[model samples]
Target: MIQSIKITLFDERTLSVRFGDIIIMPSAKVLKNAQYIELGSYQYWPVLVPRGIRLYTYEQVPGFLRENPYITDGYRAYLTSRLCIKSLFILSNETVNIWSHLLGFFLFFTLGVYDLLAVLTRLGASREDYVIYSISLFCFQVCMLCSVGYHLFCCHRSEKTSRRWMALDYAGISIGIIGCYVPGVFYAFYCNNNAAEICSSPKQMAVFVDPLRHSCSPPYDIHTFVWFGYCLQYWRQVYLVTVLAMMLAVFFAQIHPHYLTKKWQKLRSVIFCAVAGYGLIPTFHWIWLSGGFSSDIVQVS
Candidate 1:
């Protein structure tokens, strides 16, 4: 028993044991492969191994790679199928995808905080504008964070955990798309004369509008033309439904086997572009209905 318990230190990264003058180096791979060692009649268990030990192939990596088979097929030239926390910092194919979004999230988060304390607090900017801007920024943050988490942990061995992370990643994208619409609609609806009337009561405003501050009674007028609250609400409801439908489509496309094919992969870019193009309809409508258009509005949209 005493002899079996003898420990030996090898190179800086390795630990071993001396059993009857023979040293056996212990490692994660070794422990996983050989659970125990027999010294005479005594069986000794090795210490637990830390995770993030090595990389694997598409086949070797855990969970169903069917969602994105191309990920491991040299499509992501820099990607390595790494596992655990090590995957977070590694230079895998997802390295850029992960870091870009992570950095973007932090950037937006810092800007959001500054905007609240500086612009909104000082009463220099419209509170409604600030609220709408903040919502967009927050949505971008959620999207980026979700992308980072998905890229980092998608390589996990547990299929269940990986699947949930993937779902969250898709949901974040949906929310972010909706966020992009927030400021656009806000500015369009409240442009010109209606801008001052944005502080309408909650019931008078569109459901999506925050009702941050109550300023004037409805019969909200933009560009000297009167627009009833119900009319505005009807359009807002349509916009909300459209956004929800797009998000559901994105989510279902990711999960459905039919849409997981290589052909669908090529079509995905077109789908995203089409969705983006659809957003332009509102911008054009705003310009037409307001009877005026400006480069500023174009840039915001």
Candidate 2:
């Protein structure tokens, strides 16, 4: 950004000036015919305001962060989308719900890059281990946002509008739920598809261990049996959640109104709650997040 030479107001004297982020240009003179100066790799432009342009702060922030008209529109829209989706917008209640999840998207986008880098570096990246787990997690977050958005906004319109949006919301939940396991299953068992061939019993079918590359599986005599049993129980519940969420989405979205003998308005609360609840099952993220889950942190051995 080049420094402005200052405005000639009363005495027609040029004042030397340097501005960091924002400037008020006199609109009638400089703004009407101002040309952008090209400085090497940058083109500099300034906001021209009417004489005596007064600047006000937004939300207690300083400079262009508040006064830059061009910048605020994007953040405002982001704020609008997020703020409106969560039953906040009487006109578009889904706006806040939609936006909160969208903000979450920025979070996951960072995680995705970490995933690929973890794999290439081999940083002890395991499937269930969490690096590649990001893909599934991100997918579900997006779907949940869409699902919540649809349900929240659908009610704002007419009956036909409500029906369509509700159905779309249900489908989003179904898609998200089904995708939830992909990362865990894929990352946990990606290299061990061959292990499936060595199974001896139906109980042994639970032996989908990745064996930590060079490390031996836990001693199968006792520790292995204990973990296997624990994991089997865990896996069953996890799978059941996916299945149940899917069934509820499809069945409720299509069949519930048939027998409930109530308006869709009556079912709205239950539907939104269930959809939101299914998305919450993935909250184990807090644990993985807290225990140094980062691309920079890796197991040395």
- Poorest lDDT segment (10 consecutive residues) of candidate 1: 34-43
* lDDT at position 33, candidate 1: 40
After TM-score superposition, the amount by which residue 120's alpha carbon in candidate 1 deviates from its true location, in angstroms, is: 3.4
Q: In order, how many clashes per candidate?
A: 2, 14
**lDDT per residue, candidate 1, 99-150, as tens digits?**
8988998899998999888867786787666767877887788889888888
TM-score for each predicted model, relative to the true structure? 0.54, 0.35
lDDT by residue for model 2 over 1-301, one digit each (tens)? 6655453223222222336545454544554433221122232223332221111223322322333443322121112223324334232223466657667656666766776576545877554456335546655665666665554444332444444555665665555655665554333322333343434444555444323211332224434534444554455456445645665565456434442235655565665566556544443432232222341212321
Q: Candidate 2 regions off by >4 Å?
A: 1-95, 117-135, 151-156, 174-301
Cα lDDT for residue 25, candidate 2: 46
